[model samples]
Target: MSHTTGADAKGHYFVPAASNYSTTLSIGIFLMALGLILKVNAMPEGAWAMPLGAAMIVYVLFGWFGEIIHENLNGSYTQWEDRSYRTGMVWFIFSEVMFFACFFGVLYYARRIALPELASYEEALNPYMGFTAAWPSSGPMGDPFTPMGPWGIPAINTLLLLTSGATLTWAHWGLIKGNRSHLIWGLALTVLLGAIFLGFQAYEYAHAYSELGLTLGAGIYGATFFILTGFHGMHVTLGTIMLIVILGRCMKGHFSEHNHFAFEAVAWYWHFVDVVWLILFVFVYWL
Candidate 1:
């Protein structure tokens, strides 16, 4: 009897079609080139240039993920392949951790050392100057660089993302218990909560730019603030896409209790996003 199942051939590990990987790589290179050109020179208004570049990158991801799903459904992966996947996911998460660490290090340096130096130098440059070095706050002695306020949408967004993390955990439990209905509902709620979080964040950004005068160019503080949060927003976008695809697969009965490495990988990624947000909430918002 043949051990092969789904779309897999006997004794063959399921792999994506060559064209899928080739096309994805080609699109990636093209997007990089286009982005470089856009960064270097002025482009036309509503130009097809930037949008086309983004579209190509999205196209590559969609096709690449589709191929992976096809392979998973075909039963081409064995135990060894599953182990390889887990290792790959661990490494990917590690790389993301390092990326965030670098940004946080910059924040620490600016807050602990550079800000004081700038303020002291301002005082020395003119002895009569009343400049004082302090962390930004919304009080009488608050630094000018302080955000207008922090009690509104940013706080709400923090709550939304934290709740979504809990909801996603519930969904993962449903998957483990083989409760497809519970799993679907949990995932739906998580995705909706995530979208709401992002929406609120957009509102907060608009308010900051318009009212608080906080922007990427405000200073080192503004630059670090945007870089950390911006990268996190990008991760949330990716995680939401992953959840949507997983939901689609669940509807099609593509995952079984014993074979769902793809789902596991997505779950890992979602959890990482949740953790990143927790750190951001503490350092970026509360601090």
Candidate 2:
């Protein structure tokens, strides 16, 4: 939103103020997505707009979120505001869930339906595709690329995220119990774990590309695997950043046993990301 929204004539309704942030955010997101689509399809235009949009979005998020925090510190949010924020956060998470579902659904359709149909076609009619439908499959035009195993970095990442979740919960408990040290320690540990997970993921990507011949162009297998895990990694990065910010807030004597909606909201988002990664681990890696 461009400005604060609350307290209208209709029994405490939302009010919308005109601001450029909304328009900027929308345009930047549109350009980013458009650039990505075009670049993915090998367009010849200036596809660098994607990174430009990404940079704009980062700037916007920081500015807008900082404004919100300032408002909160000034005692702008009330119980009613908290309720509204909770609802908004819930819907936001649902949107993210739907977003990831589309990718997972596409992966499923490709593996279970499209690949089978392509494979079952007559060899005389479709001689190009040396088709065989298999899990962790490279499509007919793909190279003989090897898939990654779950027993290595992925498994380690799984444990890291799972432990982060536990630490986050411990932090939440500490917050509710008025134990600031415990809360700060837990958040610090969680952030450390998240960074370790990212480090391992980077190494895994290097290993995959250099050793296993698993570049994005390696075929459907590589595309879906990277798309899923790459997006998840981005989410983890964002979540970790959020935790770091919240940790800073905690250190500065922010949040309380009774009022910490911001902290709770970020924790909810972190847990949601964690759950999504678990599903990805099992479906994309082990399965």
Candidate 3:
């Protein structure tokens, strides 16, 4: 339970005593992944494993993060540790950028390369000679379905997210100026906007499935549309949860103008989510 002993005169970085948190978390992750694979394959034993794994992961994370927060509040972290955290967050966001980049790559290949190539060879294939390679195409065997337009729920959600980004920045300004009320109110508004965005997205998905016949099974266009938007919605959910946590901390006066890296880190993540959504709006929905 001992945290890093404050800064050493020898100038060595602080290394805390070992704990079993990582090992336990790894076991939980393994169980969760195995359960998912099994359940997808219709194995009965997976029913219990998935929830059990999820529970373990949640419990361990609460305990681990609680301990770190305590250590941070107790002044265990130094300039060196702060720098390391900044670098780690930078890399984490970079990895996320790459993750989405790969998905965008998939979308590009499907539309610009694969579909066009398929069109060129359609006559040669004979069976697919009737197929028309086009943007928002249902495959040759796919059912007729209306593609989603960009002007309705998607446009509203775009506005909501852009507004949330501005509100989050306002909260940062409040934090920097030591205005507790301003910070808390800004964060509260940001969380609300985020929740509203998600709700609208959920409704959009339901409409797609029920009315538009646009679904994962609807063909390649439907699959890519849902995949990109769905993942972005998940990220928004996570960002909203983080915003709520930061709001609680702000209420407790856990941060000062100078010591607010937790706030900054969450801000960085939220901004990344906003940027990604803009790209998605353009490529996946607008165009």
What is the descending lDDT order? 3, 2, 1
Model 3 whole-model lDDT (C-alpha atoms): 0.89
The model with the greatest lDDT is 3
Question: For model 2, what is the alpha-carbon lDDT of residue 122?
Answer: 92
Better of 1 and 3 by TM-score: 3
Please report how far candidate 3 places residue 25 from its true position, in Å.
1.2
Q: Summarize candidate 1's per-residue lDDT along 162-221 as a digit string, tens digits.
A: 888788778778888899988888889888988988888788788778877777756665
Q: Which ten-residue region of model 3 has the weakest summed lDDT? A: 1-10
* Candidate 1 backbone collisions, by pair: 14-76
Give the winner by lDDT: 2 or 3: 3
Off by over 4 Å in 3: 1-11, 122-124
What does the lDDT read for residue 258 in candidate 2?
91
- Once fitted onto the true fold, the runs of candidate 1 whose alpha carbons sit more than 4 angstroms away are 1-17, 20-23, 26-33, 44-46, 121-130, 137-150
Model with the higher lDDT, candidate 1 or 3: 3
User: Candidate 2: which stretches are off by over 4 Å?
Assistant: 1-19, 27-59, 128-130
